[model samples]
Target: METSLRYTSNSRSLKIHAKEKLLVNSRTRLQLHGELDTGTGAPSYFCAMIRYFNPEALTILGLGLHYNKREKLRCLVRGKMEFPVRTGVPVTFNVKGRCDFDQEFNQRNPKGAAEFAWSVMNFQEDQSVRLKVGYEIFEKVPYMQIRENNWTLNANMKGRWNLRYDL
Candidate 1:
């Protein structure tokens, strides 16, 4: 299979100046090695470590169909991710998000201290595939709290894969 992947990020208060394409191989392993442009400073660096859950556990929970039937399929992914400021200055808050795909798939808050949820879906078509991701960040501060006002960030990624099937 020949596959092409694309990624996009749209932020509300923060702006995604640039995004580097992720590289993956036939083994379904993802490797990240790139930089994203920032505003008025040096570009930010990206690094992540992801762990996938078992497919059988996911199927038992009715998350989705296990069509591939692979023993070690990826069900849930927990990422210990980091993104540094462009100017090498340490911000007051550290940003990190965790993507979980259990019975319910969701994305955690990026601030690493806030509580939030995010979800992404990958759909396959005849000759192409599309990935839609929605993220929400809810922050609660002392003296005042931002309750239900969820900040929305959406991304649409599309790609076409070339498959080599030996019948």
Candidate 2:
């Protein structure tokens, strides 16, 4: 369990979050996460998740809502697979995607956007220990009157790599 409050990047709003996780069994778990941001029409999020896991694979499914609106619903699915190399090193691959839809206030056509991300992480005792390389793509979202300008799609391409250390 965890709770937190923080100011947004611009310090224009306060963000509050509460989260908890339960280990249902040796191979399954559940989580609930909720957040609220104080700003004009800023949607609050509440998400519930279920996950199944083993030593070599994991899968997760989540459903979420914004401000309790049916139109402000979203879903996420993610999976991870781990394989052991002949050299005794282990590498893991993870992929996840999320989508959101609009109800158009019951007036206009419904539209939505999606994003996908994937990463490969190699774990070795030497040579950088743990390293991850990843890429992400976001569907282009057009400018609409009610849409937030900050969400405009301009430079959507992204690639990232990270090195992890326990020290």
Top of the candidates by TM-score: 2
Error of 1 at 161 (Å): 28
lDDT of model 1 at residue 72?
A: 20
User: Which 10-residue window in model 1 sums to the lowest lDDT?
Assistant: 59-68
lDDT of 2 by residue, 55-126 (tens): 544445444333334445544444444443333334444455554434443333222332222222332332
C-alpha local distance difference test of each model: 0.27, 0.45
TM-score of 1: 0.25
Candidate 2 positional error at 55, Å = 2.4
> For residues 110-143, what per-residue lDDT tens digits would candidate 1 score against the true structure?
3223212222223233232222222224333311
Candidate 2 pairs with clashing backbones: none
**lDDT score of residue 85 within candidate 1:** 30
